[model samples]
Target chain A: MKLTTTKRLERLNERYANGDISRRSFLTLTAAAAAATGLSMPWMGRALAAVSEVRFDGWGGVVQEAIDKYAFQPYTAKSKVKVVQGTFGDENEIITKIKTSKPGDFQIVHSSGVNYYIKYVNGGFNSEINEANIPNMANVLTAMIEPFRKITPKLSAVPYDYGTTGIAYNNKVISPEEAKEKGANLLTDTKYAGKIGGYADMTTRVWYAALQTKQDPNSIQDMDAVWAKVRETRDLAKKFWSSGAELMDLLSRNEIVVTDAWSGRVAALQQQGQPIGYLDPAGSYAWMEDMLVLKGSPMAECEELINFMLDPATSIAVAEGQNYPPSLDPTKVKLTDKIAALPAFDPTGSMKSLTFADPLYWAKNEDAWTKQWDRVSKGA
Target chain B: MTKGWKLYDQRLAWILVAPVLLLLILLLLLPIAMMTVYTFFTFVTAGVESAVLTFDNWKEFLTDSYYHGFLWKTVRVGAITAVICAILGYFPAYFIWATTFRHKWLLLLLLIVPFWISFTIRTFSWIHILGEQGLINVVLIRLGVISEPLPMLYTEGAVIMGLLHFLLPYMILNVYVSLESIDRTLIAAARSMGCTSAQAFREVTLPLSMPGLGAGLLLCFVLAAGSYVTPQLLGGSRDALFGNLIYDTIMGQLNWPMGATLSIVLFVLLGAAAAAYSRYMGLSQIMKGLSA
Candidate 1:
């Protein structure tokens, strides 16, 4: 029920447009409101200072390009506030940069969801967001918001989009039938030795390994079997791509014929007429991405920006362009055909069909597993 | 008045040197001291650490064989690269020194051309040349060579090749400066005193250029050993150098304390190499080559 300053101002404007007050009264009230807010707090001067630009860091690829084209550009045009952007191939790389930087140096992040949310929370880099500012949050799937809410009841981030990390194969070498039948096992197939690739990430590697070993990723047992399966895939892989762009490069150049690839990136490749076939095998790793406003950000402006991004038209356009489904509840807001057809799109809006990594379960094992996986990927 | 002027000259000399000395302390020594302190800090979780001083990070580094293996491999790779650079770079340095061709500076200009392009782009160019559907494979398959595309990229060899590409010019420049400084009369004297061309070259030219070659070797070795990008781009996971390990520890693992420990190890090892070079070959020769 806490209203953002923007929402309060918006209501004032609405009343004014409806002739609820005289011109002098409206002007007097506006000035009084501004003075009260600005002079009320010692630190409010910096916080309420006109934010001309919002600094945003994100994954630099087609995904970010879509966000820029569909959301950021339009918002900037409407609001006249520029969005300064930076990119990181890996989330942890940006985390390190943020650690070395001062509080307000970085503002918003296109963060990988709850799994990374824990890291931010632990690092004390999280900021409480006033949800009433983002009215569009009403349309976002409750299932997507729950995970983040579970970590911090007062959410610091809003789930924006979701996708699957599934098996992408070159259709020229692998038939759709073969890909469907083999599923996650295709990554470890000896036939594709020296032509195989995988994501060089702990969660993705361990998740696939869990699937291959017939263990649930959320409650993985038989750690040895999981490690063995991971090693099996590692020994056969030609390379372990670390970024989405690198994944596309390897696949397009045929440096790798089979690999675990992001569904959105594979969809992009298909759109470009690449002979790529994508499938979300049973227990494929699913993840959600969020717009995380970090500590010491321009809160009202960032909340307003998040609100703008979540507008159904903008969200849907970004989803279609990025080939990821919007976190907008499909049952609430109508979606385009392109979004429904996009990989990992769930019509029911329950999100139960996709097997997202349990934030608590994964966060608990991240440090140990990540260290072990790093060594394993390096021929340990 | 003359004595006072002499005293003023000494103060002027100190004033001229103070800025550089202060810069070195601030930029180099202070950061190293901070990292050394961080090496003792406890790593609680990824991206979270405590200032509670402990010897655990250093203890782990010293006790672990995994770190040692990577460090040794990095040194070995660096040594191999230096030796190869010395062999491949000598003739080019000798060519520029011995050439009577007009526009000698143009040859040196060719060496400087690669710097105009981005180092990352130069490394990425190898992908098109070495990938499966790349130029090498297409041409070889067309000409009825072995059917399979040679697995040339992302190997240790590719990494070494990338390093060589980057560091070769340094080697050539260093050796060239050494060769240029050689007195032509010394070689002429040896040649005139019943020595053949090859013998004169070995006795006079090669020995005189040793300081430059030695300097180049040390420079190439340090740069190659400390390389992070080339191996990350061109080498397979197993082919990662100590620098990559440090990167993984700090950035990937978010274990900055251990990363700091690894960094200090590399710094100390490289510093030792420089000290050893200074002991055997006067460090001033390296200075002369670099200045020229």
Candidate 2:
């Protein structure tokens, strides 16, 4: 396709931001150029008018920041394809659009866990991937790919990174022995009352609840059974955090002694000298985030982007930057001592005991479980 | 009344009003129309639709006592917020209106300055003042006045506090307009009739300002009822109001049909109540009161 007016302007704007062109020159040239070329501004600026622009729907906070820094910036610098990052990771918003929006509207999506894969993509809103285009697939850990394949059966998504839900405690406050004793129950124990933090996400919280109740984490069909254990620890919580940033803020302020957190987050904080400790507990959850290219989207380009993400150096940068272990094989990229010490960076270690979330179960019973949790929403 | 201009001149009037009407149709009417259709359809995961016309979504919502409890909880939250906003707003709005000081506009400006900042940011600001190891707790701890941090942030009280902070400005503005609209002559006349200051306020000023108070009550309650942010940010698990329920259903469960059903239900319930209220007050009277 010929370069649309929108694409030209976007490139021009990007050049301006990069200081490649002076403002006066850009204004003067674009004005003269538009008049000469019979191209206009207002109408062409709309997203629908642009073709070959890869739409990225990514995570918020650290994940987004890291992706921008380590992946998007470098990829855009090298690749011919123009990527326009839009507001994303809002599953509901995306789900609504899945039906109404035309094909190729969104080219790439990044979200954690396989729930969406089972619930949405498996249900039919998906596209196939050519692994050959993503040559770096050879470097991707088999463990990482297994979860996606297990959930969707035909997961068009490539595993980008993975992490686990565990007890993140301040080593200075709780000490190693106390944390080991409390294990997954550290956040629920009365001894840590008013100092424990909880997350509101049903997937992680339900898994935590399952473990707390001594139920088989793999089979969490009974909503009542889950809520029963959740209720036992409800009063022990200081607050239910809404975001990763909020939970991190709670810890940074010395507000929470122990909180349910992603091991990757704790590792990130520790590197920043926060003295955060992550314990696997007797039972916990491991989750992975994937990059999906929708059917009728610019697949070849997206496959290239995923390949770039899976590249050995890019993968290592993402692992270090986001503090989540890359799905790529560790042998391909060397890790610093501090990063290697993070359990998420070495998934094959003690994480065998932790149960990976049952995505199929969650996809089926999300509504019922949501109501059950709503019954005890205020764990205060 | 003008000789040249016809009251229902289609060409001229429509030309002028077309933009607004078109905007309303596209932005408001279109979405509602779509939602009405979605309300009857079945939503499966993955954004797939069955095209099967069904009332199961509506039936499920109506039959479930769990959802009814959410409705009641939302009402309670709205009532509490509206009442508190009215009470708190009255003193300040009255103070501003009664004052003949040269800087009265400055006081009003100060009242509205907080609104200039983003509402979500304002809601988040409460966390520092109310969290366990936040400003208040840190101060108290340093002073050795408390051994443990108080649980001030994540409670029903904090949610109400946030709602009041946001809704109070509207309430004050409404009440201030009514108070300013009250004829000073009436109060003077009441005083001359052997009435005390309290009696003048009760008989003259209070009655005249009822419209503003009424408008404020309705506005605050409606806004607070639909608020999802303040409660989520401030109130822990205990305060998942109706908006929260809708959000979770749509986003978490990915159940659009049920979500649309809830939306329609909320819209109908609020609309019906507002209609009843307008009928009681007379729509003209309420509008006049708001303007006043």
Candidate 3:
């Protein structure tokens, strides 16, 4: 029996050497052999126990602060899992890190909703979440959960926070009525050219254009027209901003009377006593930040962290502190009367009116948009 | 007759050059080689898939009119900025070098003062000086210069101004070195031959300083070509140059291969310019002129 087994093993090894067996199967066989040889011993367990660390990569600012206070500290205290934090500029940086660096370099990453959809869902960089392990996920609102479910049926991401793209105007320079009027007629009106500003991001710009034009953000398949409109708008635009700070600078300096801005950024500006007011006149595009477990992560602790973040109190604190709408059940947490009144976090609504950003659309049409924008901007 | 002396000199030369040569190969040549190879491949959207050998990225750049325009614009802007710097820098450099010892150090110190602050901070400071309600506009309006604020910050004029501000010193320093190295006797000889002061300066000083001017122009051009922050902050959306395009490709679009291709293109153009200058005007002579 031993001789027959040896011969069979030798034949299998020959097949593996000849590239018949895949690396996955080879790894499985190796693991089985290690188990058979008694190598899954006490030392391995002790070593793993000693190195109980989880790295969380995310964007900095209020979101990071909320994570530190509500999730990172509490989770570390309860589970003794050391949380190491790294900050990234945007999704591209995170993608670059994942592609170039070692696996599990960032076990968990906080990503924008569209980025999660494109990179995690469409690009297959994320693993399916085991919902049972994330008990606190039950607290997330149905409306917020619905979009992710519809878009990525695989449940690859856990929704974290949300914000809207809207017009932020300097109240001192532009009246509320003027701002609203401009917001209402932004797409069709060529009169306000050279005074308006917007983000440099193609996805955000496209969504804004669609909303202003009253086109269905999801249904409008042809982007060439959209690119043309955006290019026209760019010519009219005084500047294209890359960051929140730049927008604020433009507003403060009165270089721009009104501009498209993120809600959190506008809120931060308001807190700083800038005479800025944000309004979502034509129904703003909503982006849900998601915490996705990278593939090949140390899953157990990552799941624990996600569950911890999903808790109602934690979610509420993150939302209020970060100036972003939390994905958790709204009824369970107390919100400022002003925050509660915001359309995004309306507790009584069965469905929130939101234009979901599609990354696939952006990816497919980016080249065309870039070329058009280049032409328009250069006055070619 | 002197084998030991010859061996000693050879060893000394090798010892002196080895460290710098190794550093150059490691830091510059290796990265350029990798970038050259990467420019030919297409980066897969998914991380799981490996890059394949292809000419699609290069082909796209070659065929695309937008990128071609960007390339030409970059060269034009660089050339314009270099010329402006050369013109503006000549007088300051000559003035500083021509002055006596007492004023020379003070003038030199004044030239170097801007380098004390960070580049980003300096670039941002321009906004305060040139924005719609900024210092320049406000003062001008107060002085009844114009009824409305001038379009200053996000314009090509602002980009050129920022480039000039940043590169002016480099030109001055280079030209100064060249001016300082001229044989005082050459000027005396020209004057003794009955030439006017202006004529002697035009003939002798200017010709002797051509190498320095060329070197400074080349440096200014290359720096202006690769500059990102000043142009993005100061120029209009359409005014974004080649560097900005590379940034957009890499960071905005997540297309590394395209970014690599754009970078290689920039590198080749800049490298060719440098090589041509070095071939026509000796590199050592240029350096000597700069240091003069």
Candidate 4:
């Protein structure tokens, strides 16, 4: 079909906007055409040289700082590719960007495990990595990489960091031993009823409840029993929390004697001399943040960036700086004893203790669970 | 000559309203229409493809007893909050309107000062004030009022308290306008006619302020019904509201069709309530009350 001038211009605009053709790449294409038309210049060749720039989207603040210090600056220095930073408040926002924005807007995104599997893969928003370009993928521990491979054999995501969901409590009233002994039931116990709180996230809470009841976390059909148990426990709970600050405040005021808390926050509080302690029950939920390439990204640049981040030394730096466990082989890198002793980096015992959450299960049961959660929350 | 002036006046009225009408159609009406259309479609999976049309989402919502419970709870909370706001706001607004003092503006500013800070920060501050280790517990323990911290932060009461903090100003502002517009001479005439102070207030001021009270109540109700943050941060697991459900469906679940369905339902319910209110009390009265 013959295209009109306006249609040709529109196609060019679309290509440029989608980053299918960069400004330099577009100019190069035009210059080559001009050369064929006998209108070439030496200055045009210099301007047409490809400019290397990579954009990485991740959670902002200190996490971005870690990325800049360890990954961005080093990668840029080595490859001469400038790294642009994009920020997202949460996993949902990242997924939304991937779904709605033009594909090449983000070359790499830091996302939670559930989001990577459910949104990126299921939605067809991410492309499988070209394994050859990502040499460091071979360096990632088999156990760490196996989880992503099993979910999607083509490997759309690379593991970055892993953390477990566990209980945090005011040590003054509830002893660490007592919290350990009671396990997940501590939330439902009458003694601490109305004094207990936890994170408001359904996936974590449902998994915790299921694990407490000796049910499979990955099984969607089992969630009803879990929800019922959560409802019973929630009846005793003083509140369900949405943020670390709120959890800290609740712990401080003695409004909550116990709560489900992130390990990092619990550790920070313990360091501050607040009588706070964390417990990993036999079967708690664990999460890993992953990096995935958007489907239409510049595959070469994206693969290079992922490979750079997966380097043992780079991953180690990120782990140490962010206080989260790197998914790469820990033994490959040298570390100070203090940094080595960090809970996230040395998260051996807790890793086995956790029942890894299944994003598929959540995708299936989310509607019913959310509606029921709202009903329960409103005291209906 | 007068006919030309009348024609100009009519044209000026249309000119004034045209922009707002166009804006409302583009921003509000168009989105609502799209949302209604999408609600019929079924999302295959979270963030996956959606089909053209189906009744599955609406059917699921209607058939489920759980959703009905959520609906009832939303209305219950909205009604209770509105009532409380109206009662609490009426006195303060009336006082502000009746008083003639240099400090009135200062008092008004003090009432509105909370609006300057972020809602999330303010909600989080309550945790420090109410937690076991928080200020209240520490102060109470130090004063020997209690040995242990009282559980306060994550209860239904905390959610209501937070909602009150947010909705109270709207209530007061609405009622104050109506109260201020009332003529002082009418009140003086009532008093001069030997009507007792309480009698004059009940007969004259109270009747005149009904329109404002009704408007303030409706505003508070609508806002409270749609609130997600206060309940999410303050209320326990069973405290998630209709707004929270919408948030989870759209963001957490990635079930846009269901979220859209819930939103449309919420809007229709709200529209019906507003229509009912207008039937009992003219919409014009509410507008006047709000302006006052």
Candidate 5:
């Protein structure tokens, strides 16, 4: 195919963005082509200027604080490109926002892993990332990236960190021994009625419910039993928190004795001497978070930012600060003792110890299950 | 020119109202029209609706008892809240209107103070006052008056309490403005005709203030019924209003077609209520209350 001047320039730009060609080589080639064609490119300046700011939305609180402090601040200092930040209490809330907005209005999201990745892909909001651009994916665990890759052959997101939605109990009220003994059933224990709490999310509610009903979350045979268990807990719960900050406040203030909580927030509470005990029950729900690049985003800048975030030192700092295990392969990259000791950390890097939701299995039932959960949660 | 520019001339009136009319069409009518169109679209999945025309959304809504139950509950709660506001609000408004104090404006200024703070923060403040470890519970526990903390924070009662806190000011203002517009000499005239103060108030003051009270009730009802935040923050899961239902459908379920259907249902329901009030009592009273 004969390449038009515009197509040639576009291909050259993509190559440069993907780090396939060096700047000097690209400039030399472009100058030669310009001289041969006897024309100057008018769109080059506008294209370069378009990527000055990259919009990012994430779950705000300590997690975003860590990212902003360790990754975004240093990346901004180095690249001179701003990372504008927004926050959402729920992933669905952000998806709704994106749906209402025009493309490019939201560029990058701190997306919940493969399950949400499927939603974005289904909604046609995903962008194909040139793996060549984000070189630091080498250090990331293949176990984490493979899930995202399964949904889209060309990945739109890079897995960043992992944690469990474990049971967090007020140690003053419930003994650690009792928490371990009861396991996931503690959430539905009548003894903690009117004092229990849980995450107000369908996946978390259903996952814990599956465990309580002695069914596999990824492939539940008895959804009726699972939902019954959810309603049982809902009856017992004092409140179902929607955000990490609310979770912390509920735990710290002694408003709730027990709840399924984010492992990192539980760790933060423990560090603060809040008498919080975290127990990742057998078959606890393990989930991963990813730095997702949306369609119409400035690809080069986003890839550069992800690369900066994945740098070992930066990633470790963020992991330590956020109290979640980084997605860095322990064998490939040396991690700090703090990150290794964090909740849900798999030192062997095989990721066999943690159980994750089957994205396809869950995605199939997401619409129906979510609607029912919303109803059951409201005293259906 | 004078003949053409008569005050009630249709062309002059249209020109005068055109900017606001255009703004109303752009901001209000256009969004509602779009939402109405969306209600007919097919919901493919979460965040993936199709424009293929279908009546599935409306059919589901019409057949569903769940939506009906929530709508009934919202209206019930809103009515209870408005009635409570009118009862609780009237006395304070009467006190302000009949006060012998020279600085009457100070009382009205105090009424406006709550609006200075963010509404969400104000709603959230109730948590600190009503939670298990909150002020009332802690104080009661310390005083040896209560053995355990009451479950005051997350209940239907808490939702009503929150609505009262938010809607009371509107009621007070409406009542106060109506009371202020009353002719004082009429009360004096009734008293001079051998009527007791109470009888005078019943004959003159109370009858005159009914419009304000009615307007306040309507305003409170509409605002409370459409509320989303107060219930989400202060009420239990079961205390979710119709607005919360619409929010979950749109924001949680990502079912925009159904969400829009729910939304249009609420819009029509609330619009019908305002229309009924206007048809009976006239909307001018509400305008007078709001302006004052």
Candidate 6:
């Protein structure tokens, strides 16, 4: 009787290994062996899927479409779990949704900026990540993950893409040498008066402005005199841009000659022969977008999805579609001449001039920066 | 006839109107109540809403000179836009009414057809007309009438132009309805009673058309005061409106308490002005302009 049982169990195990049966049936079949051998484990998946669906609240429009096509679709094909997507972005709106929602309502979110969205981590909406589930996390570029890990709780989120925040200019109006000479201080130079475009949010803009006058941007406590310097730039600006898209529109129309903008946008326009060039003004600050698993999420599946997103092929597809630098090594994904020409599409190259912004440090002074920008820079 | 029967009829009447009453309570009163409650709460960083009640938001607005400047700017813009609309709208309306042309409907159609296109699109069109390298400036520069393109956009003049263009239709419609409704025979009677054409208009036509004129003024003022987009898109650097301030506090700064306070203050002031208008002129007259 014992010999027959061993042969029967071995055949059942072979069928399970060959993907003939669900994990649930395999567990039931192995219940007797498991009672004898103690094989219960955390890494094991359920019969069909761990969860019925994983809700992903991410930025809407083309970015979400790219994530769905390259990341969500591929994972869903393999895992057989449904993916329910919701749009959540624009820092305040995302914070409000997570704060109001019950724990684990959303399993994943494409967090745009860790510096701005770290409050959600502090609020405990996102907490744990298991390195074992995500074997591919190590394959991704360290520079992509290192800075965010420094500011956040260890391994709270993993980065997906990064870009430099610096000055973009119409080469027709300002020469490349001129932009380099002025660097970030070009905003207040007065030569570009009524032509400079200012960013509405000062996280990127303040860093540039502080570095101009030789103040430690990372250590500003009270910017008592910084306002006077900021005001110089504000006086030169015709209008402040609310988004990268809006700033890009102004550039396209020649409505603005010089502006602080994202590197990707300038690269895209330059590729189209728009006579645009992007400069890393005084060693540019790198802004990384990340994927954070929510607190109480199905750990195994969420980690699987994030790991899938970091796969070289998937990361490359996302980089091409979304105009972000692939988080993996530049050589992992072969780029066409058109894509190779764009600076931000290459991971190692983007890192050449881009430095990780200290979010934890920036988080402390973000509100002060906002207040000063509103009250003083805008001359409220 | 009987008291019990009368009570039953009253109950039936309320039952018939219950949907509208419920909608008003839900959509209007509930939101205002929630807004009022928010003004008392404290807003912290990262969109945190604290249950602790305080008047700090209101106190800040009342004390801040920055807010004062915005409030003052909103009122001035509203008043100026309304006055300009009323002035420009009356001439077209009067022309349509006075014309004996067979295609008077065609003339009125020309006035109202532009409104069929989106007002936002119409406002944006002003950009191409008024931008630095815009049509007018380009033409002027080619003609050598000016050395450089005029600073036509992002100014107070641009904002007024946008508001005036949008609100003109409303003003014209209201004034036309008032002019059309007036009995032509009354003016004839005034002229027969030893009055000139101008005198007849002053005595009979002008006084009689005051209801529509008043309604148009108040409606224009209310909408212009609460507008955010026109100033943001068209106005200069110093042209931030009250609505912009409220929006900035809520969306940009994530300070809901401050935003709610600004909204309530604006609502109460506008509500008071509307109420005064209703009391001085009849409510029916004001509503007629909106429906028109």
lDDT of each structure?
0.90, 0.76, 0.74, 0.74, 0.92, 0.75
In model 1, the runs with Cα more than 4 Å from the true position are: A1-48, B1-3, B7-10
Model 5's CAPRI class is: high
The sequence of per-residue lDDT tens digits that candidate 5 reaches over residues A1-380 is 99998789878866664445655566677777777888667645544454678899999999999999999999999998999999999999999888778767898999999999999999988777778878999999999999888888888899999999999999889999999999999999999999999999999999999999899899899999999999999999999999999999999999999999999999999988889999999999999999998876777788889999999999999999899999999999999888888889999998999999999999999999999999999999
Of 2 and 3, which scores higher on TM-score?
2
Q: Alpha carbon lDDT of residue B19, candidate 6?
A: 97
Runs with alpha carbons beyond 4 Å of true place in candidate 5: A1-46, B1-4
Q: Which parts of model 6 are misplaced by more than 4 Å?
A: A1-90, A93-109, A122-133, A146-156, A293-305, A329-353, B1-13, B101-115
- TM-score for every candidate vs. truth? 0.93, 0.86, 0.85, 0.84, 0.95, 0.84
lDDT of 1 by residue, A192-292 (tens): 99999999999999999999999999999899999999999999999999999999999998889999999999999999999999999998889999999
lDDT of 5 by residue, B1-292 (tens): 5954876899988999999999999999999999999999998889999999999999999998999999999999999999999999999999999999999899999999999999999999999999898899999999999999999999999999999999999999999999999999999999999999999989999999999999999999999999999999999989999999999999888999999999999999999999999999999999988887
Best by the lDDT measure: 5
Candidate 6 lDDT over residue span A1-380, tens digit each: 45655566666654543334544676676776656765543323332234677888876655678788888898889888778998843555666676667756777778766675566665666756766667778666676676667666457677777777788888998999999998888788788788888777667667766777677677765465566667777778877776556677788878789888777667767767898888876556677788877765666667777888888778778766666676665654454454455555543544655566677788877666775666654464
**Model 2, which residues run further than 4 Å from truth?**
A1-52, A80-82, A86-101, A150-155, A221-223, A331-339, A347-354, A361-364, A378-380, B1-22, B46-49, B142-145, B283-292
| DockQ values, each candidate | 0.74, 0.41, 0.44, 0.44, 0.82, 0.27
TM-score of candidate 1 on Cα atoms, chains taken together: 0.93
- Clash pairs, candidate 2, are A120-B46, A377-B237, A378-B237, A378-B238
Candidate 4 lDDT over B1-292, as tens digits, reads 6655665597878988999999999999999998999898878766764777899999989998777877888888999999999989999998888788868888778778988999888987876776667788889999999986786766677788889888898889878877877898999999999999999999999998887788888888888888899987777666667887888778766788888999998898888888887888767756765444
**What is the TM-score (0 to 1) of chain A in model 2?**
0.79
| Native-referenced TM-scores of chain A, all candidate models | 0.89, 0.79, 0.79, 0.77, 0.92, 0.76
List model 6 lDDT by residue over B1-292, tens digit each.
Answer: 7656675597878988999999999999999999999999987674656879999998999998888888888889999999998899888888889999998889878878887999788888998999877899999999999987788787888998999988888888888888888999999999999999999989998889887888888888888999989987887657778887787677666677888999998998788768888898876775565565
Q: Which candidate, 3 or 6, has the higher DockQ?
A: 3
Cα lDDT tens digits, model 2, B1-292, are 7776788877778889999999999999999998989999986543555679998998999898888988888889898999999999998988999988999879988987997999999999999899876789889999999998888988889999999999998888888888888889999999999999999989899998887888788888888999999987888777778888888777666677888889988888777767876876645544643444
What lDDT score goes with residue B176 in model 2?
88
Give residue A324's error in model 1 in angstroms.
Answer: 0.2
Better of 1 and 3 by lDDT: 1
